[model samples]
Target: MHISHTSEDDNLKRLLSFSAIAIKSSCGEFDIYGEKDTDVRGKELVFERTRYVYNDALEYFEDNFLSQITSLGISLIPESDEDATI
Candidate 1:
């Protein structure tokens, strides 16, 4: 089935873009801690790895989840103030 892009799709893309920006800004860096190796005495050696959280998140959204969502041709149009009941 061929799905045509509409104004709703554009709106959804804008929303997604804005959300990604927010996520990137808030999650700038993260501390990743894990066990790196063990000594001869069986003592575990721990390490702290600093990574850019936003880059990882952006990669995931663009390379993985976003592709899937686009393939499914799903779009969302948020309700405006005029449509709000309360």
Candidate 2:
């Protein structure tokens, strides 16, 4: 079936995308990291410390995971400035 989303629906959809990123990252499907240091760094990838966060992690999701979906010519319109903040 075909369905269309209004502006309100679009905003909600984008906001809800955070949960998807969280779940996939937590499950080791989408890695929120780039490089890793060991021994001198205790050999681990930690969040916001040994690893990255916020924009870095968000960028990882967009480039690795989200890009694949959105690249299929899907109409994933950005809701608004408010949606961009999240």
Candidate 3:
């Protein structure tokens, strides 16, 4: 049996929400929707460090991925920011 489209949509939505939360949390943003805001008080410094690490890692991966593809001689058409949102 195959997964249903509804389930796929729900999973995608949840993943996107999780990514948003991770980005915010890494940047020391208050989690108004959860108890982490109070529970992690005084830990924003650590989260601030995490933000740099995450950005560095993301940049590394993007650069590595692009280099791998370009080295294979496959030309990539650049997409506009809106088209690349997902």
Candidate 4:
């Protein structure tokens, strides 16, 4: 799945963007932005990290979001064969 977030706060935006990309990659899926010209099947999940503004958004996502999604039986596709060169 693809995940992303944006905020007026630069730090939060950066953190969320980084965390989203990391989470998606770790789950074996490429970041959405990286697949601009390709067709893929997956849901784009957005989180309101601003709610946990003071805490580490990355940690919260790992502890809360990742596990929850995994439990739901969603499978992350490994890097495509074409990406093997990279």
Question: Which is better, 2 or 4, measured by lDDT?
Answer: 4
lDDT of each residue in 15-85, candidate 4, tens digit only: 56764554455454544455432212222332433334335453564566555446322345344643775
Q: What's model 2's TM-score? A: 0.24
lDDT per residue as tens, model 1, 40-72: 111110010011122344444434444433322
Better of 2 and 3 by TM-score: 3
Candidate structures ordered by TM-score, highest first = 4, 3, 1, 2
| Per-residue accuracy of model 2 over 1-86 as CA lDDT, tens digit each | 12365746554445445544444344333323433222112112222221223334544643454443333212223347437778
Q: What TM-score does prediction 4 earn?
A: 0.39
Give each model's whole-structure lDDT.
0.30, 0.36, 0.40, 0.45
Runs off by more than 4 Å, candidate 2: 1-5, 30-86
lDDT of 2: 0.36
Cα error, candidate 3, residue 61 (Å): 6.9
Q: Give the number of the best model, judged by lDDT.
A: 4
The per-residue C-alpha lDDT of model 2 at residue 81 equals: 42
